[model samples]
Target chain A: MNHHAAQSRAAYLFLTPFLALFVVFLIYPLVQSLWLAFQQTHGPSITRYVGLDNFKSIAVDRLFWKAFWNTAVFALASVCIQLPIALGLAMLLNRPDVRGRAFFRLIFFSPALVGLVFVAVLFGLIFEKRTGLLNVTLHAVAGFDPEFPWLQQYVMPALIIAALWLYAGFNMVFFLAALQNVSRDLLEAATVDGAGPLRRFLHVTLPAIRPVGSFLVLLSLIGSFQLFELPYILLGGGGPDNQGLTVVMYLYQAGFDAGDLGYASAIGWTIAILLGGFAVAQRYVSALDER
Target chain B: MTPTLSITPRRTLAKLSAACLTYAMLAASAAIVLTPFAYLLASSLKTGEDFFGSLFLPAGEGVFGVAWGRITSANYTRLISEFDFTNNIVNSVFLASTTSILATLGAAMGGYALAMIRFPGRRFVTNLVLFALIIPAALMLAPSYQLLYFLGLLDTYTGLILPAAAPAFGVFLFRQAFLSSLPPQLLEAGRIDGCGELRLFVSIGLPLVRPMIGAFVLITYLGTWNNFIWPQIVLQSPEKLPLSVAIAQLRGVYSQDYGLLMAGTVISIAPVLVLFLLLQREFIAGLTAGAVKG
Candidate 1:
């Protein structure tokens, strides 16, 4: 066979399975879903091209907006809490002198192994209004009544705590690996040049892991958008007054509960747009900081 | 020099404080991560009265006394007799194993092609895989469900296994590993020996990508085992449900039976913990592979 022909044949042969599946499952569905976003649907089947009617409905839908806002808040709160705590833990664990680091690392990373729904259930028990561990401990310590409804009144904070518990260790493992990849020579050189631990970390270590940091930020941002199973299981599918409703949960509800598949598709597309926009904006800001 | 060499109490105290602070933070963080599991274990062993009474304290009481007052094996036994937890476990393990195997095979071939072959559309395929990484699986849920329902495969293992086996992340990871680690001349040498392309891939490529395969298998297995939403939507029958879904059902039905529910939750999470402990090195490598790069 000629070289070009051989190459083509090999490429086609090797790519057959992935290509077929991608077209059938990914590409086709992707296009179909986008189309479904515009078409109005009474049930599972789309009726007609409504030309932004679904989008208009989503724009004015109170529940949809509540979920969107709740998700945004959750994402911001999680990133803020998870990143700093992860960074600190990663730094401490990276220290060569730290004893029992391996054991601590395993303990820290254990929660991520638990399924999201399981964590939600576990936290639900922990945050139970009267008999929860939190209230019980508080009552014993301060002689106060154990009546606070954590999952209901403080839904956002409770959700954040659960998110942090489920994810912080996973993030820490990432940061720890990145820290290991940082050159020890650079750190020692900075220390010898009279830079203290804080200064050296801020100026030298952070700059070295900038790529990893950026990547983590982007991944966390995407993860924040895709928040579903936890909120769905906990707080009874978005809690009291929809305080815990996330965008994806809302989309699921729209499609499954309300039978508005077209509107749900539109909501899904809107999430994609929002995530893309946020990623771009984050990249822009990071680039500006670098410059 | 002599004065610097001498240990001072003040400096010792400062160093001690630093160590204490580090240990304190680490201990507190560890407690927060582990306390929930501890509570779960404790609650599972206690009866309702003891569970309620010792909510915050350690369950110093025996497992048989207050926590497990109804000491009948009904919950555990019922999981087999009535709830089909055993069948769900089998279904989950079977689906995860099949997905892992299929995903690894496809990833090996595609990764080998990308790494060794000078093919057209290589970059295009790579970019497509990366794009798949960003497209949240949630977005695909509705269409995927409808497509499966249309295909009459909604409740079948084939439906669950096949769709997941084609994940682009596995392909991307294996391709990156092959490109970075595998030398190009090995393939050329195999070609010179008159080996056919498929044989070369099977004999040489598969061995070379074993670690990546292991990593992919663990990742894929974890994803499948912990999968909830897709199976929830697709499987209508409880018998077909995976452990994750089954556990959710148990929670829904036995909301008040904290001990039984906690036992079920513990069982659900045990496999994951075991897998993580066993393949932790590879799991960390896989996680780092996804996180440290695009």
Candidate 2:
């Protein structure tokens, strides 16, 4: 074979493993998920077509709505609460006068490496009623309630606190990088123009980091929507009154726990659509902001 | 940027106070962030009684008013002996390492082809990879489970490892890394030197993207190591379960055994954290590289 033919042959050979696996695992499963959403199945077998019944049931599904609301709350908290603190920390670290930047950065970023499952395991105990670290510390510091039912009464807040610890620093790293790349000249120009610290930050820093900020928001949203392992393990499957039910956890329960793969696929489809909507909305907002 | 305004005494005092406030916040935040890990470590050493007795370390008639004598290794011992966590640990090691290595090689190869090679349908494959990026893993859980069952790969490592080996995210990252770093001329040079295709890839293509390899391997390894849901669904046999599932199950069975649970948590977290500490630069760069660049 000539060089062109030979190179093409070699390229296909190189692509074989990834292509094969991608087809079998990703493409096939994705298409099958779309198909499976319309039909109910017992385990992996005994499927029956139910048209739009799965989606219809999920439409009025109070449990699914609760899961969606909980997930939305978490995502909102991530963007509003977590990302602001992250950006604030990033601003702190990005200061030219700051010392031990790397040390603080490492400390802040460490929990993110703990992974979601392990974070749940650790926080599972940390959110305990009286002896839990949170309650004890709060009780000592501010006369807070020692017997506050975190996993029971304040399930969403408990999940939010755990997620904040897990993700704030991770998001901070991104913000820090974006902050570092902010045009120093423009900031100095704003300072020279007698803009206050807040004003300068508003005009220069905020606009500059908007892209990364939005990206982090979308990422946080997608991640929040798929909140399964953390809540599943932390609350031990949708805590009291199913207050901690997440979309993916609900999907898992429907699929594995309840052995209804079809309903699970429908939930999966709903999550996909919601996430895709977030992506598009984010893109549109970012595009508008650029103008 | 020089100070356009003169530094009055009031300004100096303000700056100093601001610095002090910044330090205070950073210190407090760091403490809050690290308190749980400390709590985990201390809890793992305390018995069930001591767990309720003290917040962190048990307080007693020891140095610093701490009950050092009450610290115990029984939790770790129980994890291995009574709970058979050692088998889970081994299974985790096997699955994580194998999956990571295979994934890195597969992604590097596929990415190299997409980035460097001139062939038919390259655009289609590249677009396919890009399209795959937005398809969330959660979307595939149910169907993939059924597919695995149909293939009779459930309860086996192959079911878990094979799907993860060719992650679209890894391939896209590797593709970006190669496009930015790997030189077309270098590959041409290797070709002119009469190197075989495989040799050119293994020797020349691989070394050019070493940092990507490091980052991708660490990412994949850490991902597989910490992954819970997929394995929980796929693996039915207890012995085949990795540490993630094993730890969850451990908690399920012995939720009240705070020490044992914390001990298991420590085992699950320590290795990956240490690996991250060692290779944090590459890992962080790899992680944020995608968001910042893409």
Candidate 3:
């Protein structure tokens, strides 16, 4: 009994530092945010109890809907466009015939190391009207418009393109790992049976990598939904016509810029609920796949 | 089934073409990916006048139609002399290293307890960690800021580092690492040999999960180094601000100065890229371990 008591004591002592900070920082904030979501506040101090008004306002708010639309479109583009290129790159790298695979992967993955804010700074110049790298290269190559307004008129596309460059290779790392794990025996058997490359991929490789694919999809979606710093820095605050506004940017504007923490809390909860739906759906899909 | 017969001229030609195509595609993608980085480096070197005068380097009668003399270190020098980026760099290094070390230690200890010890509340704490994982960070932003305000820690590094040091994600990672890599029998033997609990953890448990410690430390350091919003919210004093916030402020003020902005970014990004290159294996392994295995 004494020995057991000593072990328990040691365990509690080990856990104390983490548990103490987690409770104060994580748990308290979580509960407080729940309460704050239903109230109205100026800054963090001045408060008024306006139950559900924030949520209701969000329901009908045009800017919030626009932000929602922009975020959804980004997420859709990420899944559809970016993930395919990532998978393609992974497939190419997974080939036994490919040499210098590591070198190629390092080159592709290097950009992901650059933080989103810095990416914004670099791409901000890259997307400039005349002297920007994109326009200059395009103009030289194909006589493309030198004065194209990427950040202004084509906000979502520009965001998607920037993100594609940043994340496609990062996601490719996951797909490559999955590809390398696909059963070689099954692949060889299909090949011997005269299964062409596309058929072999569709029949043998795709099913094996399905789990990792779903995981990457969810990861990309969650990340896309949380987009802020890229557009916030690149477009310099929602671009020309609030076209680059994201949910988190809107939340930051509400809380810090506008000094309405209450409405910000509401926006945060809305995002939480939406992301929760994604998680649950992901679980459901995985469960179905298991069955 | 017959390797010799499979080596026909048409088959060889087809395979060669396929290989060529693969190389061609990969090379194209690699060039596209590297263009911005090359542009960034080139842009940082150019003078303001030369920046607009040419795309990459100022075109002239020097080697390969490029004016070698036009490339200047003035932007970099100005950053150090005019703008105190050195201070921001120091702040970034301090915050990142301090937060990573503290967070790693706390996580390893917490993981050791939850994974190896048969305490009464282990299940409760484990459940709490899981619940905490799904809670969107955005939800807590307003409340965490308010909490800091009430505690009078708003502008302090403690306000920033303390909260981050206890990330549920780190604890969960270490727990998984300990559960898989650490054996209960070893700990029991250490206990039987009269080794103190803390000593056992320090010497035995930590060694067993050294890779996790390294990986977790790197992840936390990279995260803290790159993090903007939290520190931007917490710290008000200019001297206390880290690189991420500092760079953003620089952009705000010198948005038009392309050379200066590029130089600042190059400085901000180079260290992490070099670190990632050195620790690429451990970093990639740690990044994908949870996703792949779980």
Model 1 Cα shift for residue B23 (angstroms): 2.9
- CAPRI-wise, candidate 3 is medium
Candidate 1 lDDT over A263-286, as tens digits, reads 788999888886674457445333
In angstroms, give how far residue B276 of model 2 lies from its true place.
Answer: 0.8
- Per-residue error (Å), model 1, residue A107: 1.4
Q: How do the candidates rank by TM-score, highest first?
A: 3, 2, 1
Off by over 4 Å in 3: A278-291, B1-5
| Model 3 C-alpha lDDT per residue in residues B1-294, reported as the tens digit of each score | 743257888898988999999999999999999999999999999976899998887899999999998899999999999989899999999999999999999999998999899989899998787667767677788999999999999999999999998988888888888888888999999999999889888999999888888889888998899888899889999999998888888899889999999999999999999988988788777777766664
* lDDT top scorer: 3
Better of 1 and 3 by TM-score: 3
TM-score of each: 0.91, 0.95, 0.96
Better of 1 and 2 by lDDT: 2
Q: What residue pairs are clashing in model 1?
A: B46-B67, B47-B66, B47-B67
What are the candidates' interface root-mean-square deviations?
4.2, 3.4, 3.1
**Native contacts recovered by model 3:** 0.66
Lowest lDDT sum, 10 consecutive residues, model 1 chain A, at A282-291
Flag clash pairs in model 2: none
The alpha-carbon deviation from the true structure for residue B52 of candidate 1, after best TM-score superposition, in angstroms, is: 1.6
